[model samples]
Target: MHEVASQLSADLLGSGGLDRDSGLRPGAARQEVAQRFASVVADIASGAVQFPLPGSGGTSQRFAALRAVAQRDLCLARLVEGHVDATAILAELQEPSPGPTERWGVWAAEPPGEGVTATRTEAGWRLEGLKQYCSGAHSCSRALITATAEDGRRLFAVRTDGPGCEPVPGTWQAIGMAGSDSPDVRITDLPAVPVGGVEAYIRRPGFQHGGIGVAACWYGGALAVTEPLRSAAQRRPDPHTDAHLGAVDMQLHAAGALLDRAAAEIDQDPHDNSGSARLRSLRVRAFIEEVCSATLCHVSRATGAGPLCRDLRHARNVADLSVYIRQHHAEHNLAELGGLVARPENTR
Candidate 1:
């Protein structure tokens, strides 16, 4: 799977087709990359690819796989190299595929509490107000935007455009996942096709499925950072540093188990919501952040500031992971999951 992801990434980076104008039209190379990514994900779902390592920090492997796929696709679409906006690439994928739409939309509305709004307009539907923390927004061609209609009811999927939407300038600076480019966006009088009626959009199967993909991405990034730490641990002789490595390893393992369980629940029976799945996701994310942050501290403390000056991989990883960790609803979702778990019915 890693090899496949690497090939796809290389193909995308090497493909001269990626450029500013490349986003203006959907080209074969972009489609091919998307198709390959979809195939890899399918394999994962089908158990063709193993996820979550057996012992500690297995979740990192899963996250690495997910990131490789997403990053490769984004690269193919020229999103990472800065030639194209991430939102546009995502919009292209949102277009209907040849098979039944296995694709799920991952959306996050900003302000963390207010719902999105979509109203009918002469030019399709006018989407007004803010959508906070939309990861892949720059690349997502279609999204199930949560908004309230003029009538004050929750509505969704109003206007959709890849390039038409622009990032709220300068909002996304953070520590990790800088390449994610999950920036704020505003839609004005754009056109769209409703995937389902307002209520149905929120209640769709795809909605639940979306979380798993994100979980996978988080897990992968955790692995990417941890691998270096593991290497450092092997080389270092200090017992104090070794003890920190042990703690980081344990945290990673626990997080991976949570992710694996969540993935199973999502694949087996998506609608159940059991609240456990969501809780597991929250657990994994929190644990991942903790472990990664600690690893950074340990490595920096042991290696000293010398490494920081030589090459920026560690710093870059820290920065990227920090930003990526702040996906929409992260804290709020965890709180909601806690609430649900505390409820009597959720105990079952």
Candidate 2:
């Protein structure tokens, strides 16, 4: 399944099928892209395009296909000079049966000031507050912000450009995923649309799946880091170095399996909230952290600091993977796993 998905992704890349300049009508292009996306989603639903890790087996390809779809849409959006909020799209895909009247927003950040209210106005909602750590802010047409209201109801889904809503430049100076452009945005009396009901955003399956997806991305990053090392090891093997490479390989495989199990559980029961699913995600992330840490350490030890030359891909991989693994839930996730295991039920 991964081979087929890889072929499709390769074809999309090779033929430039997703290119926005293909002269295809906007509607046609949208349809085509949507079709491909649907295909990918179907593959995911059917266990055809398994995520976590796509080895050459029945488990199917995992994170690579999902990332390919995401990258494809992002590139297409860039070419068309239009943007789609990937977080929102993922949420919608995960929750297809959301109520229409219930607006849905994804605002997870610390409020800047106090008593800032988000109100509904004639044109749109008036949002006055500051939103920080907006991951896809620059590229999203609309933002689901969390702001206080005069009545003290925390409001979400303030427009990005309506009225006084402003996108203050994001302060994201991270080493990895610099392209994510997560910045702090300021909204002052901005006109906005309300998303789903209060707390609706948190209740969706996508919210949990998004965490898994993040793990998947890290999994991909680990692979990206390991691939070069694997190639190098194969090309030139030393007995001492072979031992280190074997250890790295074992860690990578274990991490991949954990991610795959998490994906399966999430897909099978989107609303489980079971310790098992949470444990799976937590475990996957932990393993990924270990895998990346070990792989980088082994690479550095095996190859020495000479590979730190700016031109070396290994150096960049090391840097990127190192930074990427520290995303929102690294230590917290590990801690959560610890808590879960400490529970009486888990002890059994």
Candidate 3:
């Protein structure tokens, strides 16, 4: 936990700190983030970072514990954009992934177009066409790409350093998460290795589980940005600022409580391959999203634009949270939650 915290602070709160235009060009910024990832990979590879898999313990206690750590170190996640999501995907794959030195990206975005495809080659599997939202494109050494195969959608792990792979420039345009470098990746028959069969990526209980972990990252970012407001309220004597601080504090407190409950539930039924994990993940993500949104608004209102203009770390965190929380699917997710709630299965 301490090592992860060190890596996070080193990457995000570096010498000069980050700004809106920090990683727009993708040169020095790319190398800086890659170094940070290398540090994390070193920890994971050396077994310093121990994350419990399904059924690691008698119950599922370790999974929830690791998740708590994820939430605490979310500032690093915010710093590097969504690279941690890809890392989580790699760690959670059915097949044992490569060593920690080999970074990974989760490239599963399918827009209205010819998504990535998997082709059988004499040597092995090959990935063709384009994959969208390839975060950590330049930095990550490998990627787990979802592509259409003969039967249905399957997950494929391809080495990003291969000849046929390319990270398209001028594609990523988000000012808030520019450091992520999530541009389009062009794959021209890059040799690939299949991780699992059709729909295995989406069908796994860990998929839903991972979504909540992402919400934790967002919650962490919100916490970082809202810290200034709390400090102001503590030192100042303004009723208006105090009121906003009180409201945001209540929100974060409620979200923290919910996160704790979700962690406990996850530990109780560690190996719930059933759809029950969906409910817990949806509730956590949605509630945290609400709390984070409220935090951003209240902090902005209470502090005005002075901190945003002067304080680089706080401003960057606020912008990053704004862009990062959009991972929430909004109505579609809510509708899914409603459907899950309607299903009266395993009633406790």
Candidate 4:
């Protein structure tokens, strides 16, 4: 597993890789991140590295791989996770497999804004409108995008290299996770192939499983943010730092154990036959999000502003994680979870 981490780090940050010095401009940094992501995707296509499918019994191994990538670069991990997730969604829906070297992204973010709308043309389906938070916007060759259709919300696969899809420049002005290259994409009547029926994307069992996979990435990012504090404690040996470290350990250890148990349960019930996947995913994601949030607090409180000012990697990890974990809907998700727990069916 360490070797896997090292290999991923090397692939992403070694040699003609991401400029980690913090001196490079955002344009250069975004280009480098995209290039590295493309290289990693090529490697995956070539069988040099492979991620296990969710609920494949090797789900722990899959999470480990995501963690390894997030530990090094959350931007890359975001793209990698999206690509792997696209493949998994396609497989689960019995859609045609992606091309050998095609890099895919899942652009299902439905935040309040003008979103893509799907129309059935004489030829086929066509999409239009602007989709926000399209990560790997300029880098992905293909994408599984969700758009509102005549019937309901549906998922569609579309080629991004075509003429109709354009990534709106300057839309993503984020300081954190900027290397993800997420931008608002304007889909202007782009041809698309519908992957599944209305609402199928969220209705699948894999939807819950994928949410946990994201939690796995959050766990890894938390590990990355905790690194400087761990090193500082090792170097200085202060009681105050040790106390923070102890708290971090407790949080991370419990989070990891929960993740492991969740993975095992996923393997045991890949199809959600036991009807617990939704509740389990919500709990795992919420728990891990809290753990990561706590870790950031502990590390920052223990280390103060020095690391944020001095260490580029640590600063980036801190910033990236701060933004990434916001994907967990916090109070809204908690309310939903509460509703589930209060349900008569769930009580039994």
The candidate scoring highest on lDDT is 4
lDDT of 4 by residue, 214-254 (tens): 99899999998998899999999999999999999999999
Compared with the true structure, the alpha-carbon lDDT of candidate 4 equals 0.88
Better of 2 and 3 by lDDT: 3
Ranking by TM-score: 4, 3, 2, 1
Clashing pairs in 2: 50-61, 50-62, 51-62, 102-196, 103-195, 103-196, 104-195, 104-196, 125-192, 170-183
Report lDDT (Cα) of residue 132, candidate 4: 90
List, residue by residue over 1-348, the lDDT tens digit for candidate 2.
134346335554334333433222433443454344435434444545444421113222444454344333422211111111233333453423212222222456564444346776777667776666555444344455656555544435444534564556425564343334455666676765555555555555545555555555555555655555566688898786787778888887776677666656665665655636556656666777777777778867776666666323444445656765665466777788899989888886
lDDT by candidate, in order shown:
0.48, 0.51, 0.68, 0.88
Alpha-carbon deviation at 78 in model 2, angstroms? 15
Candidate 4 Cα misplacement greater than 4 A, ranges: 1-18, 21-24
Clashes of 1: 34
lDDT of 1 by residue, 211-305 (tens): 44454455455555555556767887778767767876777677666655655555555454454544554555556555656656666676666
Best by TM-score: 4
Candidate 1 vs candidate 4: the TM-score winner is 4
Per-candidate alpha-carbon RMSD to the true structure: 8.3, 8.2, 3.7, 1.8
RMSD of 1: 8.3
The regions of model 1 sitting more than 4 angstroms off are 1-64, 67-95, 98-107, 112-116, 134-144, 151-164, 171-176, 199-201, 273-276, 328-334, 346-348
Query: What is the lDDT for 239 in model 3?
Result: 97
Ranking 2 against 3 by TM-score, winner = 3
Clashing pairs in 4: none
